[model samples]
Target: MPELGLDTLKAALPEYAKDTKLNLGSVLGNGQLPEQQLWGTALACAIAAGNATVTAELAAEATDRLKPEVVRAAKAAASIMAMNNVYYRAKHLIGDPEYQSLPAGLRMTVIGRPGVDKVDFELWCLAVSAVNGCGTCLESHEKTLREAGVPRGTVHDALRIAAVVTAAATTLSAEQALG
Candidate 1:
């Protein structure tokens, strides 16, 4: 229940000063232009992590390097998105009379093998949902994780990674054009 102090930091940071400002990339892009958005979301996640220098450094690197970092970060974010999508579908299925009646062992083979600890996965889901602007995903993950006893810090940390990765993505394009 401890505060992460993000509100205070947000209030102090300027609009562009914080590399984690990625509403444009996550909400507007809808993850269509990944190469571009990777950098933006990475920065946003990094800022959420409270590591401005490292995120900025990734941005400063040459396009070749910067692009890779963006890819890695964005890929991580996207992977979580896909995972959540699958998990939610499976969850819905479990609510059905047929799936609900199935044994746990069978369920594991069909849906649980790829699943992770709901707490851990939900934390990542929250981050990607925020960056990807999936309100339903965000709300569900947020609600579930809170109920699962995940500390707020854990959620904040995951979001920080998403923000940092998004910001780092932008440097790639800038560097590529110049390089």
Candidate 2:
């Protein structure tokens, strides 16, 4: 794909929403993380947000930079988080001692072996958790990432990618709704 492939997605935003367009550009161009890692995180966030357009566009663009296994791991991160986020978030929010103590019984083998660098997988999980609005998952992933020696700046950049992709997807949804 072209170097500006992400720009194509960014341009899909309504021209009047200059701030969202500019934010997409900035996040996609962020240098705090490697391009591969950034795109991987974005792909996971897009998938977690259930935005088919953004997910397909990001996956197509990321294939050039990320290993196939790495890309798969990003997808797995989104899928697993989709389940875990709901369960864990409910447990946290409910705050009932009985519910919190119960075994989640969630299948999350992917977290242990995501077929990529563990930190990269964790970063993707963090991005997805952010999109899923699971404060529990977010805190867990962020702490794991930081303890694993991942820099805070890199974590921030990954979250930035998640935020921008989510915003862009919402913009596209609004565009579709207005049509």
Best by lDDT: 2
- Displacement of residue 87 (Cα, Å) in model 1 is 14
What lDDT is obtained when candidate 2 is compared to the true structure? 0.84
Query: Model 2, poorest ten-residue lDDT window?
Result: 1-10
| Model 1 bad stretches (over 4 Å) | 1-77, 80-115
- List, residue by residue over 1-179, the lDDT tens digit for candidate 2: 55445777776778777787798777876556886688789889889877677777777878878888888888898999999999999899888889877888877898998888899989999999999899999999999998999889998988888888898888777787798
Best by TM-score: 2
Q: Which portions of model 2 show Cα errors greater than 4 Å? A: 1-4
Q: What's the TM-score of each model vs. the native?
A: 0.41, 0.93
lDDT tens string, model 1, 84-151?
54555565545666754554342222112223334544454567666555565777777887888766
**Which pairs in model 2 have colliding backbones?**
none
